[model samples]
Target: MSNDVFTPSRPAPGRTRFTTGPLPVLLASALWGTTGTAATYAPASAGALSIGAATMGFGGILLCLVAGRSALRVLRSAPVGLLLTGALSIAVYPLAFYSSMALAGVAVGTVVTLGSAPVFAAVVERVLDGVRLDGRWALAAAVTVGGGVLLITDGVQLGDAGGAVAGTLLGLLAGLSYAMYSWVAARILRGGRHGSRAVMGAMFGSAALVLLPVFAWTGGPLLSTGVGVAVTAYLAVVPMGLAYVLFGAGLRHTPVRVATTLSLLEPVVAALLGVFVVGERLGAMAWLGMAGIGIGLVLVLTRR
Candidate 1:
């Protein structure tokens, strides 16, 4: 786990945006999509909260270290409100996301969490940032969310009805938290005082502080099993640390809304992993739902 994976070569002056920008983000999302599948390999004793906390808490510190002095400077000089909200959202996202997967199963949980992010981003942009919504995005979101509904209704039941309900709610919260953090990152970038690495470092580093106690409490079981420890380490290093670096690079050329929507690949990857690796079943309706999401992503990605 070197941060070198996040470091894209400098593009030539005439290089396409795809090569220098969205590709990295898409790759990052693909890596993110593998998280729930990978978590399945962990020992059963590992709680979702602890997994989430460890992923962000430990990984965040590593990100901060890589970001170095500029990251610290940005943390010190950034507005208190922005920094606090970003950190808080970051802290909440992984907790809600991992728990959602545990209760709802990987496919449904990842679909709900990642699928809803674009909608949240759209709303945040409109209400807070005053960015206008284009018709393509609106239509694309409707189609994608419609697919999400199908996945939710058609998802394989995990625990009780209460667990499903709770997971879905938490998934929505995860989506909101994700959108909030993305907005914060974009805002920080707009300020031009900090680089993307610094912005991410600042946000997650503070979030790591918030999650450290939770990791300590719930992480005891993680150490009980060697598999759990290894999986946790993988999650922290690959998906959390390296993925965010690529994500930051991607955001350089992509708007938050488009970036989030592009990340819909996450759910598709998660679903594939759930079916292939985790032995989860996706019924016809769920397959159709996945199709809708795919179509929606294609529409959005192809739009001028």
Candidate 2:
């Protein structure tokens, strides 16, 4: 699950960038989009909490292993408050994200979680860091988030209002958690005091410590069947571990807002997976919604 595709190359004359190109980030996001589809294969006994815990807990360890001494150093030397903040977000994100999908189905949950992240990220930056949103970003966000809203408009069944409501709320939590971690991680990378690998490893590892006990309570079912075990392993190794490695690479040089916008790819791919692999049905409007999100993503990336 290595991502050699993100290896840095020499920049053009007078240009210097260490971050990965969009291709790598897009590829990583495509991998992440598979999480919901993969989770669908898990046994019914494997709850969302267990799925999230196994993915992050195991993936965090793998990331730490990949980062080695740098990861340890960052974890030890980083400010306690910063580490705690990042870790709290990390711990909550997967739990809420997976729960959202479990309750709301893949397409809607993925859309809500990833679609709202850029907005949350923008607000976090503006309020805390005093960064201002540009018109292009505002336009892109509007179109993308509007598309996400379209996805859930007619998708939820009449009697499932409670589940839909709870799922959407959890999705918001996931989005905010994601934005917080991304902003914090990007800020840390901007400082040049830690590499992306170290930051990801430290943040996720700390989160794993917080999540392990929850996994103990809920994860036994994930190991009950071969299919469950395999799905869990795939989620950890590919989407959670390898994808984050590529995400870390991208974050090295990309602005946090841009990075969050680029991540819209995840939901688009997830929607397709929900329809094809997960056997979820989507109407023409849902397809159009996916297209709108894609268009918005293209606009944002090209505007940069």
Candidate 3:
């Protein structure tokens, strides 16, 4: 298959695209949803920054290892500016995402970070690729973001005002960073010079180098407890490494805007886990929000 997957001029057949695209992204989102809950099992001495660094740093390295020679070739051949942008965005995302959850609550933090990403992704597509999203995508994105807002509002209590505010800001940053890297990856994939695994491996491998110092500084507490080590390993292997591979593959057949919108599934999964696994309670509004998110996904998926 051509790696130039997202070009406006070379559209894939609708049936094939829709059928093949969404499943991997959805699976990836489901795995990503477990991150917040998994972090809860980490040793108390492991700070949020430590957990974040360890997850991405270790997982990024694993991606490079699995990708092997293809990753090295991509790094050597892909545009340096593009690779740097992706790496920096990847580095920023984990730090902000983890801190946002620690400062705000998991439900609120996850919703805000993920909800804002589609909008940012749309903007990135517009400005960089000159891509104009259709009404269906716009409507789907709006509905999903609205649902995410509702999901967080009354479902979980926030921390002190200042911390919540800071966390919200950080979550926005994380969202923007997430969008940037997603866009970068899609752009590289659309270049037709690299495979999904190669692109992801190259980007994340570069990012691991940037995150190494952070992890070295903060990751000491992770080794202090067996549970912490296990949780960190799970986060690195399952969510960051494997899930992102799935995400990159999905980007081959899905537009950046749609992919980010589809990722709204992550928060939905997270919310459900909170309610059932973590014994958190959700109000009627939260339930309605979940329904709205489902509606939005249906709208996008059923688009002709």
Candidate 4:
């Protein structure tokens, strides 16, 4: 759950100028790659809000304890617009994600949703944020998307099934949520003068507030067994809680492409889990698709 995504540093004497800053940021996505697998066992008792609240709350504790009074000051100063942006963005993933999974299936929902985040981010940055994109970035994106398609088709079935349609829609929503979170987080980071921790903390607090009623009304989790509670706690702590902090912090320090590309490992792991852990079947064609996706993703990550 907790990843070393942000580490303050001074440049070494002979380090490449462009490659300065923390390595933790670049590593964050790889750390985040474990999310889906971990969340598989989360408590059915908890809804997205409760799960998200637990995660944000626990993660915020870490930042608060580390920053002390400064953290509180940052929270106080963060503008209402920025807070709403963070809360709304953060709210999207949990609410829509599980809904998609329930309506569709894991493969259809997760791939379409999470896979498209970077593409959306790239577009938003170019069109709205006024960031420039290079030719290689274009090629990299092409390969990346192609690879994702290969993986999704290979790993998941997407005929005219009712579930597939729902899942695909959910996946689309997931991508949109990812885009919103990235953009809003960027706003908070810049507007708060790098007070990202405080901004995130408040955002989580707001999300928790939104979900509190749901949590109370639900009368607890679907899981009554000990295993259920354990699963929920793990998901809350690791995937939802820890993963977001790593992701947010990494975004603060790393290239968007690097972080997003690395995050692709999530589906790869998911596919593997489907086969080995869950006893799901995959065909030879699917294996080839997985290979292509892995290769394409590697290219995207390794290319200059």
Candidate 5:
């Protein structure tokens, strides 16, 4: 069956993209928020790289299975340069993201990666698409990024200065990779040819081929315990697979910059989960930062 079956409907009259677009992205972000906490449940034997590889590798395959022939069609017909760029970006994201968290603290890594994505996405749109950024988006982006930094930076310890530097660099690379893939997918979807699922599956499935080798190299520990296996399964199925499905759907109605900004909600959800589920404590600044993120999101969603 064609992946167009999953295509979202157009917004009703009087509803703007800002009004209708953020919901699916927000939902995807919520699912993505569970990833950090979920990774904690994995066995010690499971290295961060292995966990990342398994998550994207299995999840990408699942998306390909779901997209079926449509994905194959997209691979055949989409611009080769665009497809390769998107696929390579997708492959790099997980590896850099996981490694950054391993070297830097989770807070620093998450903040750097997610916080930098909106800016990078905006730049991509500007340079490649000739899109101009408006004041509202700029303000909203600044607010969201500031909030994210404030929210995640509480009590962060960057052990080993050299490792921190390396991790921060990797985090930046991950952010750029994220922006590139988002732009490429949005570009493909905007072309009005392939379905979102087809684009997602084609790009990510090719990325899976690249990542599976890494998984094979580092994924042995995942088989060492039931908890590890379960964690890996959950990460693959829920956050990586289903979340990207929602993300792709959101991309249909949302601009890349807005979509990336909306995704700031992920860290908020992650922080809440960390506090409530993982018994981590948050300071007043963290609460204040969360509020800032909420305000920023409201700005992004408002239609003027």
Candidate 6:
């Protein structure tokens, strides 16, 4: 994850202004928008399994090598409880997400899953961790969640159609899992940046191990399909791998609320990408729906 490499450094006095620390997060999110179109190239014959495993493996190795001994220490020094917990918790998302993308389209998969994450994160952090959401953020949440609902339903048609159902459920579950991941990773990174990065990679590796078998059966086909394969690599390395690292970095600096709020931008970005990059044409209503999302984000940023 090249994104991880640019984790914003802690600022000394007079060092960080408003945009000072969020640069990596912004860049990472931008690159993350590239995932959907890229995955189209992977072998249609292969499921998302191979794609998930290969990327995690590659990302883990890259992180381990770059961080060296510090990375080693996260695996070695972690108490049993935390290590097992991290491994088990981290494993759920990639399996859910890549498969979700295969079952649904990239536009649907990424937007739906990540769209729900902040809402879930807010609730989880508030109840489980006792974090609170104030007035403006709540409004922001409503607008964002509403926008997401529109995006997912594709003009607000809610039905039992198999593809739609799979996309909605998987995406919801993925969002929850991602929230958990962010929460747990934030804990590991709290000690220090070096130690944090190491532990995160180790955690990713631990989770990646569980996803290996799924890939074993399907990976060959993925490599055979040029575009899908390229997309898979991009998803694996950038969003899955690098994004996780940068996400960790951002979480370390921002509060759970702010972090969750900022994450809402992901789905909005995905929707835009679908529009421009993938030529996903939206009718006027859909375009208006997307505009609502933009307005919601603006409100979130500016609301007192």
Per-model TM-score on C-alpha atoms: 0.90, 0.90, 0.94, 0.78, 0.95, 0.82
Which candidate has the top score in TM-score?
5
lDDT tens digits by residue: candidate 6, 93-139: 76677677767766567767766777777887788778767888888
Clashes of each: 0, 0, 0, 4, 0, 9
Candidate 1 colliding pairs: none
User: Alpha-carbon error at 102 in model 4, in Å?
Assistant: 1.9
Each prediction's whole-model lDDT (CA): 0.83, 0.81, 0.88, 0.59, 0.89, 0.65
In terms of lDDT, the best-performing candidate is: 5
Better of 1 and 5 by lDDT: 5
lDDT per residue, candidate 4, 1-304, as tens digits?
Answer: 2221233454344334223322343344444445455556666555554544444444445444544554455557667676676667666666577667656666656667666777777777778678887776666566656656766665454655886776677767777777776676665665435444555555665655554455455425624557656755565556655555556665564456445555666666677776887777887755665676666565654554
**Which regions in candidate 2 have their CA more than 4 angstroms from the true location?**
1-21
Consecutive 10-residue window with the lowest summed lDDT within model 6 = 12-21
Q: Candidate 3: where is the Cα deviation over 4 Å? A: 1-15
Regions of candidate 6 where Cα sits further than 4 Å from its true position: 1-17, 154-160, 193-196, 225-229, 302-304
lDDT for model 2, please.
0.81
140-247 in candidate 3: lDDT tens per residue?
988988888888887477969999999999999999999999999988887877778888988999999978799899888887888988998999999999999999
Model 2 lDDT, residue 99, Cα = 90
Q: Give a tens-digit lDDT track for model 1, residues 190-235.
A: 6756777888888899999989899999999886888888988899
Query: For residues 1-304, what per-residue lDDT tens digits would candidate 5 score against the true structure?
Result: 5447434456665556544567889999999899999999888778878988999999999999988898998899889999999999999999999899999977788879988999999999999889989999999989988998888777777999999999999999999999999999988887777887888999999999999999999999886898988998999999999999889988988899999998999889999999999999999888888898899999988845
The lDDT-based order of candidates, best leading, equals 5, 3, 1, 2, 6, 4
Per-residue error at 122 for model 4, in Å? 1.3
lDDT of 4 at 281: 82
Better candidate by TM-score, 2 or 3: 3
TM-score of 3: 0.94
